[model samples]
Target chain A: MLKIDELEKCYRNKEKRSIFHTTKSKEEKKALDGINIDLKEGQALACIGENGAGKSTLIKCALGILSPTSGSVRLFGEDPRRNKKYCMQKVGVVFGQKTNLWIDIPVIESYKAVKQIYKVDNDTFKRNYEMVMELLELKDIIDVPARRLSLGQRMRADIGLVLLHGPELLFMDEPTLGLDINVKYTIRKFLRQLNQQEKTSIFLTSHDLDDIDEICDDAIVISKGKQIYSGKLDELKNVYADKHIIKISGMKTGNILSLFPGVELTEKENQSIISWDKSCYSVQDVISGVFRMYAVDDIEVREPDIDEVVSRIFTEGVSI
Target chain B: MKNFWTYLKISIKSKLYYRTSFILNMISPIIVLCGQVLLWKGIFKLNNASDFADMSRNAMFSYILIAFVLNNSLNWSTENSLSKDIRNGTVVSKMIRPTTFLSQNIADMFGGVLIQGLFYTLLVIVIFFIAAKDLFVPSFSNLLLFVLSAILGMILRLMINDFFSLLCFFVTGYLGIAWLKNAITNFFSGAMIPITLFPVTLKSIAGYLPFKYMIQVPISFFLGEYTFADGIKTYTVQILWILFFIILHCLIYRKIRINLVIAGG
Candidate 1:
C-alpha cells in the first residue's frame, strides 16, 4: 500500500562566521540516507532502529508531514504530497507524545471534531464511534475531559479517534513506550484484532521488542539511517538463530567448553551451560552427545527472544 | 460548516473546563478597560479640550470602549501557536490532516472572540451604560458601520498575524518578535489612544496602515466622526488593505511551505 524510492532528508545548518562581518557558513545533517521499502496491503511492518536512525524522518516523509530532500513516496498509486487529501483519508497516524485531541475538551467532543474533519456520515460515525469506544474500552471515559485522563487512557482515546474514520493505513510510533504492562498488552491485542478484522496495513515503531514480536508479521531493521535487513519475521529468526542454550542444572563441570570444537561454556555456582551453535551440530545430535558425556537432569532449548536478537544486531553491528 | 460548529463546541468545552481561568479571564479585560479609561480621562482633563473634533468626554469613552473590544477581537497571535506546534512536532500531524491550517486557525479565532471578546464587550457595555451614561451613545447606523468595520478589521488583522507567524517556519525563537508586533499593533491601532489625538502627521500615516483599521477606523465609525461618504472612503481603503494582506499572507504561506520542504522543517 506504500512505496518509497531513494528517500533522503537533509537539513542545512547555517553558521555565522562573524557577528559584524558578512560571511555565512553551512553544514548538512542527512537524517535519512536513501531508504527504499514497500509495504504490501494488510502487512504489519515494524521499523526497528536506534534513536536518530532516521526512522521518524522516514515516516514523516511517507506521511507527507515533511518533504524529503530527495526521493519520492507513493501511497497506493499516487504521490502522497500531491494528493494529500486522498492520502490523508487513507491513513491514520498516532504520534508517540502528541495527542491530536484538544486537551481540555471531552474525549467525545474531540471524536466529533475528527468526524467532521474526515466528513464521516452520521450513520457511519455513530456506528464506528460505538465500536471504537467499545473496542478501546473508552465508553466510560468518553465524557471526561482529555486533560483529566491518564496517559494510557489518553493514548487509547487517541487511537480510538484514529480508528473512528477507518483509515486503511495506520502509523503507530512508540505506541507502547512508557505504558504499563497491562496497557501494553491491551493495545497489542487490540491492534492484532483490528488488523485481522479490517485488514489494516500497520507501520509500527516500538522500543518494546515484545510489541513487535506479538503483532509484526514482517520486519525491517535500520541502523544509522541504513536498512540492514528486511524480510519475514520467521526468516530473520532462522538466519540469525544460530545458537540455542540448553540450561541444565547439573552439578558437574567437565570443561563444558571442550564438548564441541567451537562451543562456548557459561558456568554458574551450581550450574553449567553450553551453547550449541547450529553451524556446528543439530539440536538432536548435541542432545545425544551431551547425554553421553554428562548426566543430563533437565534441559530446555528454545529460540532466543527478540530482545536478545536485536541486542546482538546492535552490539555486533552486523551487516545483512 | 459542521466542523465550524464542532470546533465551537470543543472550544467552549475547553474554555469552561477551568472555571477559575474563565473567571480570571473575564476580569482581566475589565481591569484593562478601567486602566485605559482612567489614563484617557486624565489626559482629557489636562488638555481641557474634550470637545475637539466634536469629541466630548463621553464620546471619547465610548470610542475607547469600542476600540478595546475591537482590539481584543482582532487579537490573533500566530507566533505563539506556530512556534508551539513546531516545538512539539505536532505540526507534522496537523499538516497531514485534510483541513487547511489557516481555516482551522481562523475558526479557532472565532471561538476565542465569541467566548472572550463577546463576554468582555457585553460586560463593558452594561457597566459603561450605567456608570458613564453620558458617553455619546451610538446611533443604529453608526452601530451597523462599527460592526462591519470591526469584522473586516479582524479579518485583516488575522491575515497579518498569520503572515508574521509563518515566519517561524524559517526564523528561530520569534516569541519576542510576536510580542513586539502585538505591542506595536496595540499602540498604533488606537487601542491606547484615538489616532485623532495624535499629531496630524502621525494620524495621517497611521490611516494607511492596516493596524489603524483594526481599532481606529472602527472606533471612529462608532463615534460618528465620519459622514456616510467619509465612512465609505475610510472603510473602502481598509477593505482594500485587508484584501492586500490576505493575498500577501497566502503568497508568503505558499513560499514558506516550499521553504519548509527544502529546509526539512
Candidate 2:
C-alpha cells in the first residue's frame, strides 16, 4: 500500500543574520539517504532506527508533511505530495509526544472535531469511536480537557481521534514514548488488536523493542540514515540468535564443567548453566552430549529476544 | 467550508474556556478606552479647537469608541500561536490533516473574533451609548458603510497577520517581528491617532500601505468622512491591497514549505 523510492530529505542551513551584512550561505544536511521501502496492504512493519536515523523525516515525507529533497513516496498508487487530500484521507497518524487533539477542550470534543475534519460517515465514526474508546479505555477521562490528561490518556486520545475516521493505514511515531509500563502495554495491546481484528496496516517507529515484537511481524532497521536491514523479524532473530544458553539441574558433584572445558559454563543453585555460541554447538549436541555426561535433571534452552537481536545488529553495524 | 464552520465553533468555544481571563481581557480594553478618551478630551480642551483633522469633538469621541471596538475585534494574534505550534512540532499534525494550513488558521481567527470579541464588543457599545447617548446614533446609511468597510478591513488584517505568521517558519524568535507589526499597525493604521492628523509625508506614506485600509479608511467612513464616491474609491484601493497581500502570502507560503523547518521531531 505504500512505496518509498530513493527518498532523501535535506534541510538548508539557516541564514546568518547581522546588522552590517547578510551573506548568502547555504549548507544542506541530508536527513534520509536513499531510503527504499515497500509495504503491502494489511502488513504492519516496525521502522527500527536510532534517534537521528531520519525515521520521522521519512514518515513526514510519506505523509506529505515535508517535501523530500529527492525521490518520491506513493500511497496506494498516487504520490502523497501531488494528491495530498486523497492521501491523508486513507491514513491515520499518532504523534506520541505532540498532541493532535485540541487543548483547552474536552477529549471527546476533539474526537468530534476530527469527525468533521475528515468528513467521516456517521456509522464508521460510531463504530471506530466505540472500539477506540473501549480498547484505549478512554471512558472516564473522555469528559476531561486534553490539557489536563496524563501522558498516557492524552496519547490514547490522540490515537483515538485519528482512528475515528476509520483510516485504512496508521503511522505511529514513537507511540509509547514517555508512557509508563502499564500504559505502554495497554497501547501495544490496543494496536495489536486493531491490526489483527481490523486488518489495519501500521508503520511504527519506536525505540521500545517489545512494542515491535508484539505488534509488528516485519522490521526495517536503519542507522545513521541508512537502511541496513529489511526482512522478516523472525529472519533477524535467526541471524542474530547466536547466543543460546542451556541450564541443567544437577548436584555439585556432577563435574559437568570439567567435561565442557572448551565451552563457557556457569553454575548457580544446584544447576549447571552451559553457555555457547549457537554457531559452535546445536541444541541436539547439548542434549546428546551434555545429558550423557552429567546428571541432567532438567534442560531449558534460552533463545535471544528481538531486543537482543536488534542490539547486536546496531552494535555490529551489520547491513542487509 | 464545513471544516471552516466547525473550526469557527471550536475557536469560539476555546475563547470562552477561560472565564477569569475573559474578565481581565474585558477590563484592559475599557481602561485603554478611558485613557485614550481623556487624553483626546484634554488635547481638544487645551487647544480650544472645535475640530482636529476635520473631525468634530463628537466625531472624535465616537471615533475613539468605534476604533476601540474595531481594534479589539482584530486582536487575534496568529503569530503567537502559529510559532508555538511550529516550535512544539504539533504543527506536524496540521500538515498531515486534509485541510490546508491557511484555511485552518483563518477558521481559528474567525472563532476567536466571533466568540471572544462578540461579548466584549457588546459590553463596550452599551457603555459608550450610556456615556455619550447623543453621539451613538449614526445614520443607518453611515452604519452600513462602516459595517462593509469593517468586514473588508478584517479580511485585509487577516491577510496581513497570516503573512507575519508564515514568517515564523523562517525566523527563530517571532517577538521582534510581532512587536514591529504591532508598532507599524498602531501608527500607520491610525489606531493610535487619526491618519488625517498626521503630517503630509506620513499621511502620504500611510496612503500607500495596506495598514491604512485596515483601520483608517474604515474609520473615516464611520465618521461620515467618505461620500459614496469616496467609499467606492477607498474600497477599490483596499481590495487591490488585499489582492496584493494575497499574492504576497502565496509567495511566502511557497518559500516556507520549501524550507520547512519544524523544530522538534
Compose the digit string of candidate 1's lDDT tens values, residues A67-156: 678888898778876787788888898876777778778888888888888988898888878888777899789999888999999899
Query: How many residue pairs clash in model 1?
Result: 0
Question: Positional deviation of A245 in candidate 1, in angstroms?
Answer: 3.7
- Please give the interface root mean square deviation for model 1, in Å: 3.2
Whole-model lDDT values for every prediction: 0.76, 0.81
TM-score of each: 0.88, 0.93
lDDT of 2 by residue, A1-320 (tens): 89999888888886686889878587888878888889987889999988888888888888877777888889978988778889898999987878888887898888888889899999999998899888889999999989999988899888888899988899999999999999999999989988998899999999999999999999998888878788898888888777777878865544555655557878778777777777776778766777777676777876568887877777877665
Residue range with the least summed lDDT across 10 consecutive positions in model 1 chain B:
B256-265
Docking class of 1: medium
Give the distance in Å from residue A306's predicted Cα in candidate 2 to where it truly belongs: 2.9
Candidate 1 structure quality by residue, lDDT tens digits, B124-206? 68966697665888789988888888888887777777676666677666676687888888878888877778888888888
lDDT of 1: 0.76
Q: In terms of TM-score, which candidate is strongest? A: 2
- CA shift of A109, model 1, Å: 1.8
- The CA lDDT at A307 in model 2 is 80
Model 2's alpha-carbon lDDT is 0.81
- Write one digit per residue (lDDT tens) for candidate 2, span B1-265: 8888888777777767777876676677778888998899899999899887787888888778777877777553433576567667777877788887777877877676675457766876786668765354567788789888988898888778878877777777877778888899888988888888899999899887889887788877877778788888888887888888888887876666566867767
Clashing pairs in 2: none
